[model samples]
Target: MEPRPLSFYLLAAFFVLFVLFLYGPTLTIGILSFQGPEGGLTFPMRGVSLHWFRDLFQEQAVGDIWGAFRRSLVLGLMVMVTTVVVSVMAGLAFRKRFAGSAVLFYLAITSLVIPSILVSLGVGLIFDQLGLPVHWAGAGFGAQLTWTLPFGLLIMFAVFNRFDKSFEEAARDQGATAWQTIRHVVLPIIAPSLIGVALFGFTLSYDEFARTLLTSGSHNTLPLEIFGMTTNVTTPVIYALGTLTTLFSLLIIGVFLAGVAIMGRMRARAGSDAGKGV
Candidate 1:
C-alpha cells in the first residue's frame, strides 16, 4: 500500500493506545494465569501450565465463589427486567413534552455521571435507618436498582431518539389508541435497543462492586468475593478466574456488537426495500 497520510498515522496510533488502555490489564491477568506459584512476579516464560485452572476448580473457596456468581447472575437478571420495564414506561411517558419532563430526563442521566461510591454510602446509610431488607449478598440489589433504573432510562431514551415519529402519527391517524400505537409501531422498532439496554444493564450489574460492597448485607456477589480474595492468599487461581471473567466480558461485548451489526443489516435491508418500492 502507498504511504498513509499523517491523519491516518495519528488515527492508527490512537487506536492502538486505546486498545492497550482497554486490554492491558486483561492481558496481564491472562499471562499471570499461567505463572507457577514459585514464579510469582517473574516475567517472560515461567513455563505455561494449567495448574491454576485446576486449582481454581479445587479451591476451598470455589463453592462460596460460585454461590456469589449465582447470586450476581440472579441479581443481574432481575435488574435487567426491572430496568427494561421501568425504562420502557419512563421512555413512553417521556415521548411527549410535559412540565418537568426536561428536569426528569436530566436527573435520570445524572445518576450515571455521579460517582458510585458516594451513592453506595448514601444508600447504605438510608438502608441502615430504614431497616431495609438486606443480607451481604442480597442487600444491595434494591439499592442497585436505583442506579440501574436511571442507566436503563438513558439507554431507552437513546433508543427512542431515533424513532420515526410519523409511524406513531400514522397509527394515531388510523384511529389507533395511544397504547395501540406504542404496541404496533413504536415497540417493534425499538426492540433491538431494548435488547441492547438489557445487555448493557447486565454488564453494569455484573461489574458493580462499590455500591454492592456497601449495600450488600449477607450475600457476597462475585466481584465482592474477588475483592475478598485479594486480601488473603492471592493465588494463580485468582488469575484463572480473572481469565474466565475476561472471556465473559469479551463474550458480552461480542454479543452486543453482533446485535448492533444485525440491526444495521436489517436497517439496510429495509432501506433497500423502501428504495425498491419507491
Candidate 2:
C-alpha cells in the first residue's frame, strides 16, 4: 500500500476549510430563513418558524417572486439543453482540424475576456436595431450561451484529450456508421462530463445578472428579481428564497450524479457478466 505524502494531508485540510468558507454563509442563510416573521437579516434568531418560506408565496412589494422564479426555471432548462447540444457538437468538431478552427477557439476565448455588461448592451442594441423585442428566451439566452459555450468547450477539450480513438476505430471496423459510433460508444463514455457541462450552463444562466440585465427587457430572471427584492423588502423572505433555490440546484446535481453512478454500475455489471461467460 502507498502512503500519501504529508503535503497531501495539508492540501486535503486546506480544501476542507475552503469548502466550509464557501458554504458556511449559505448554511447560515438557510438556517436564518426559518427565523420568525419579525426577524432581521443576520444572527440571533428571533424565533424559528416557516414564516419566511410562507411569506415567499404571499403577495408583497418584491416584484412577483413566483413569476420570476418560473422564468428562471424555464430559462435555465432551455439553456441547459442548448448548451449540451451546442457544446457537444462544437467539442466533436474541434476534435478535427478545420479551416479557421483556431480563430473560432480564440473567438470563444474573447467572449470570456469581454465584460458581460458590454455583451448585454450590445445584444440589447442589436435586438433594438432589428426591431425585435428581447425576451428571456431570446437575446438573454444567446448572451448566456456566449458565456456557457466557452466553458463547455474548454471542459470538452479536456475530456477529449484523455479519450482513446481506438474505440471509434473498433466500432468502424464492425461496420458502424459515424453517427452510430458516436451515439453508441463515444457519447456513453463522455456522458458524465456532458452532464457537468449541462450543470454549468444551467447554473451560469440562472445566476447570470449582468448579461441578462439589458437583454431580458420585459421580465426579470431570479437574480434580477432578488436584486429587486433587496430594495423593496426588509424581510427574511429573501433568504428563504435563496435557500429554496440552493436546494433546487443541489437536487439537480444529485440527479446527474445518480445517473452517472447508475451508468457506471450497469457497465461494470455487463463487464463482469462477460468475464464470467468467458
Candidate 3:
C-alpha cells in the first residue's frame, strides 16, 4: 500500500479508545486485585501480593460470596438449557405456519420491550398472589427466561431462516421419520448456533442484576451479591472477586468457542470422508 488514508488512522484511533473505554475498568480492577495486604481500593500499588484474593477465601463481614456464586452458576446452567430447548422447538414450529402464529411469535418476544426491573417485580407479585414462595430457582429463573429466551428465539429464527430445507427433505427421502430427521439432520447442522444461544442464555442470566433483584428472594445471586458489596465492603477483596468472575466468564466463552471449533472440524472431516467414499 502506498499510503493509508487519514480516515483510516482516525478510525483506528477511535476503535482503540472504544476498547479502552470498554475494558479499562476491568483491567484496573484486575491490577488492584493483586494489591498487598496494606493496599486500598483506589490504586497506587502498595506492594504486589495475593492479599485480597486470600481475603476472599476467608471472608467475614461481606455477604455470602461463594454461595451467591454457586447460585449464579446453577441458575445460569438452568437458563442455558431451557433457552436452547425452547428456542430450537420454537424455531422448528415457526418453520410451518399455523393459525395465530404471528400473534404468538410477537407475544413470545413482548418481554423484550418491557423493563427488566418491572419484570422482576411482576414475577414476584405473581408468586405472592399465587401463594407460592418466591425463590431464586423459581421466580428468578422465570424472570431471567424472559430476558434470555427472546434473544435465543431471535438467534434460532435467523439460523433456521438461512437453513436449507433440502437437507431435511433428503433425510426424509432416505426413509427417516420426522423425529429422525430432526435428531440426525436438523440438530447436527444447527449445533453451532445452539452453542451460541447457550452462551447468550448463560452469560445473560449470570450477569443479570435488575431482573434478579426482586425475584431472587433471600438468596442473592453473584451479581446481586456484588452490588451489595459495593455499599459496605471497601476492600480490594471485591476487586479480587471481580477479577475471578471475569476470568470465569471468559473461560466459559472459550469453552463454547472451542466446542464450536471442534464441531466445525468434525463436520468438515465427515464431509471429506463422505466425498471420498462417493
Q: What is the C-alpha RMSD of each candidate to the true structure, in Å?
A: 2.9, 2.3, 1.7
- Candidate 1 lDDT over 164-205, as tens digits, reads 789888889999998898897887788778887788678888
Q: What's the alpha carbon RMSD for model 3?
A: 1.7
Candidate that scores best on TM-score: 3
TM-score, cand. 1 vs. native: 0.86
lDDT of each: 0.79, 0.90, 0.93
TM-score for each of the candidates: 0.86, 0.91, 0.95
Show where candidate 3 strays beyond 4 Å: 1-3, 272-278
lDDT of 2 by residue, 1-278 (tens): 79999999999999999999999999999999999877799888998999888877876645587888889999988999999999899999999999999999999999988999999999999999999989988999999899988999999999999999999999999999999999998998898798789889888998899999999988899899898888877788889999998998898889888877887888777653545656
Pairwise lDDT winner, candidates 1 and 2: 2
In model 2, the runs with Cα more than 4 Å from the true position are 1-16, 271-277
Candidate 1 has an lDDT of 0.79
Tens-digit lDDT string for candidate 3 (1-278): 68999999999999999999999999999999999889899879999999888888875746689999999999999999999999999888899998888997887778887888899888888998999988999999999999999999899889998999999999999999999999999999999999999999999999999999999989999999999999888999899999999999999999999999999999888763555656
Residue 190, candidate 2: how far off, in angstroms? Answer: 1.8
- For model 1, state the Cα shift of residue 69 in Å: 0.8
- In model 1, the Cα lDDT at residue 233 comes to 45
